[model samples]
Target: MNGTNKGGAAPGRGGGLASPRFAAVMASQALSLLGMEILQFVLPLHLLNLTGSGALYGGVIAAGFVPYTLLAPIGGVIADRTRKRGVMIAVDAVLAIAMAAYLFAAGTSAVIAATVAVLMLAFAAQALYQPCVQSAIPHLVESHEVERAVALVNQVGMLTGIGGPVAGGIAFGFLGLAPIVFISAACFAASALVVAALVHVPYEPPARTAGAVATARADLKEALAFLRSRPLMWRTIMAATLVNLFGSSFFNVCSPYIVTETLGLPNQLMGVLQGALAVGGLAGGAIVAAVPGTLGIRRVPALLLGVVAGIAAIACVLMVPLPALGTYTALVILYLPTMAVCMCMSIVATSYLQVESPGTLVGKVMALAIMLANCVTPAGQLAYGVALDIVPAWAIALVAASVTAAVAWWLARAER
Candidate 1:
């Protein structure tokens, strides 16, 4: 955790509990990710069983993003204004309670209601928590370690991505949805505990500049104005937004059905696909870590190249005529490298933003970026959902891949 600062000032890095704090944060994040993955698996299965409609399954996933779009700004403001640890702890508690509610209620209507409620609350928490965590990293470690810290964060996410679904699938087969809920609840609760245990967070005095009502509006305005002034930030946001809109949307909306229907793959095979993506993500993180430099500066072109190459690999899967097993295996292979490269680039971009931006305004800028990027995800999902009716799945995927590649290329050039 002993590292450098963005300012190039080698401040006396505190040692007490830094290791423990890092461990606590990683464990909590891993648990939270596991919980989310379990829910991702179970929620769809629940929706499918309850409504027997693919659209409903899509809707369930879409519902989670709603708050990311609507409440993210508010969440950002609150995180900036409030104590991050307290906010994080409170949100974790709320999420735990929400999951508990879902566990108690078993039917479709109840599940939907619970899902909506949890998502609304969880989204609000995430909006606040994410910025807080991002902002807090600098406070916890030396500046030089920021990249590693960011990579570790991505790694934790990947670990959850790899493990959560597989465990959820197993749990689903034997113990059912309740187990998933219980696991999610446990993760949140554990995260809350970890937050409570954190002792080294450098305290920033409360912002005394603005009142609650006026301050919020001004903060939002200032944040937006700040972003407008930075062309690079705007371009980065645009690139991320477009990628999410096309690539992320298509994958989320189409992948499950593609596996279950088009590819005729079993649920277990789908789990493997998910796991493979995580594995790719882990590998990407390792690559990022091993390379010693500002990934934001050093690897931009290479990252974009990987993205283009990975997208082509994925697109190639569509052209290959293979049986279900072969297709699933091909997808797993394609998925790992694609996701790894994509995530590495994303991590670099995010770390760059966090490190380079003014600390005071970091929450607002990130919130806006998240809001804009997330807003497009649902639109992408909706567009693909409609397109699937008329267009072949492979055709839709090809378009998405092509669009994403072109956008990524444009972004790379624009960023440079």
Candidate 2:
């Protein structure tokens, strides 16, 4: 169907606000995210239990992103040229099988090998599936509704983020890692089934010249050239890269360490902290959903950078000592909201990019941007690992906060 009707509302298969098929797709994605959140905690914890090496744990996380750098462009091409729904289903099935294999072989050398393989496949699937999902939204909804649609998706993800870790930790504590992996596999299978039942996305036509190598090269070049032409795109990408480097670096190791080391909190408390951040993210998503339609898209990127700056500054303050339980609780409360604001801004920027960019080029641009952001994460984790050896945890946190604030401001002003 054409994207719009004479009334300027988004046209769906039937006369409705949103296509049922599209809603089903969203539901599947939400479930998939929930499962992913569980695995996010379980995987690293398992690695630490097995090896106890910070560097090795960091490497395992880095390996997943490495394929995105190498294969995302290709994945984008496949998404555009093939049937997107089928591609998603195939990818999901493969991931589920791989995860199941890992579960069956838990704790062996084979388990690690299989786990890495499954993660790589999952990463590739994620790269392809994201663009397909984003591209599908415009087709299913009105242009004016794009922002709301994106916000809803982000909200679902955030909600899952809040629950996934808590559930994962419980499962790990009670059922062990094998059960966690099996459950994750089941979630992926469920997601695939939901997609199959609900979505009827149209199949893309095949390329006219089936084996046209030169045409593929041209597509890659054009996507890169388009990115280079937009200064704001480059600056936004740089901003996101730096933010991920400083902010998420600690996420890979610090939260677990903090719970176990500093506060002498239990694993359950660690789960709560991780889940609380997601609650903050959900609040941010709500704020984005509430924004008026008249504002310029350019404001999104700038506001997001500002929020990042605020987060860094607030983090610095939270690092200070408190004499009482009540004071520390107040500080934690304040820090959570700051994190939410930063996450909300970032989500808005992501939505703006998805809507503003051309459909054919969107996949490549997103892939490249994510790859750049993720590539540096390993380095950040490595830095944190080394710093933890010499510098105190609070000092490392302060340094990270300082660097993030500086980078955020630089990014805010860079394009303007």
Candidate 3:
């Protein structure tokens, strides 16, 4: 039901994402993502390089997520109430300004605190902004087109994952970090203008008199009630949350540990492993997009749980000292399947979540699901670190895998 055309762009003539608005937004996404990824790549590396303390760097990085998790639900509520196009435009503009602020903090400690604050705000803006874009997809296309649409949307990110970092690295190597930041700023600003001129879809705006806090609260309550009514979807969300909490935690804390401490490998190898996962994610998103209707709601939990199991297997293999296979080989063998499985899980699961709900509730529901799923990530990462000191890395992985398996099994049974 391609609804109303508010701003510009003709309605897509066919069900195959024929809307010019979709193309416009996708173009905006590409530019915006290219900017964001460069900054995301450059920032942590800069921090790590400057501090030379992983603890300090990780702590600073973790701190940014605090606002993201808390503000994401509010963002969802706003998306439901306002035109998503405007929300995206505003967020992008502000992010561009934030990047400019970081430029001031680029060389010296003069406004180090300000730079960090700006970075935190930028991260929060991103977390908030994502729900709006995701919620906008169904409004732009017919119901049957959602899977392909979401997959196509996801491809923007996948493409950025491949291009952004490499370009960021090249920029950093040749022109330095400041130039990359400047380019990022320009990208967001350009994206704002593109989206402002193009996206057109009608959504019900909430009452202006109600304060944002109250509106957000009401929106979240409604989303929770919807979750209460849908058993399978709720289970998928919860299972996904548990996996996000521990699975990412393991990687954030334990993967490096496995690579550096346990595997006794160089630091560069870690980058290789991360690149592998990014490539794997790109491959997975393309697969989902190409296969159109494969993402049934009931099938999602199994796929996710299977991914978790793959992580467990990868963890177990890392513990072993293979005779002929080198560290790189073992990493390739263990990492590929786990990353690929998770990639498939993410492609199927998130697309299902975004398009399955009613448009009115989609934004808030998407935000709440993403926030709840990700809220514990930082703390879980810290906990994994602490746990590693008390227990061993291999021991921790075994427990994590078992817990993940149990959750997956429970989800599977619930779905049946």
TM-score of each: 0.90, 0.86, 0.84
What lDDT would candidate 1 get against the real structure?
Answer: 0.71
Tell me the tens digit of each residue's lDDT in model 2 across 1-416.
11222222234432222578668778888777776777767776677566655555566666666676567676666655667788778767876787787766676777666656666666767777776666566556666676777777788888888888878877677778888888888888898898887776655474555365666676667767876797776677777788678867765565565454455545565676777778887887788778734334455445554555544554554466754343335435654675677666666666666565666665556666666666687677777765654565666666666666677567646647
Predicted candidate 1 versus true structure: per-residue lDDT over 23-136, tens digit per residue: 666676676667667766667765654554456656666777787787778777776677777877887788888888876666555767776666656666677777776666
Whole-model Cα lDDT of every candidate shown, in order: 0.71, 0.66, 0.70
* Number of residue pairs clashing in candidate 3, backbone atoms closer than 3 angstroms, sequence gap of 3 or more or interchain: 2
The weakest ten consecutive residues by lDDT in model 3 span 1-10
Order of all candidates by lDDT, from best down to worst? 1, 3, 2
In terms of TM-score, which candidate is stronger, 1 or 3?
1
**Residue pairs clashing, model 3:** 12-18, 12-19
Task: Estimate, for each residue in 312-376, the C-alpha lDDT of model 3 and write its tens digit.
Answer: 77666756766423755765666666766677777677766665676578888888888878787
Better of 1 and 2 by TM-score: 1
lDDT, model 1, position 260: 68
Over 4 Å off, model 1: 1-10, 13-18, 49-52, 108-110, 297-302, 413-416
Candidate ordering by TM-score (highest first): 1, 2, 3
Q: Please state the error at residue 392 of candidate 2 in Å.
A: 2.4
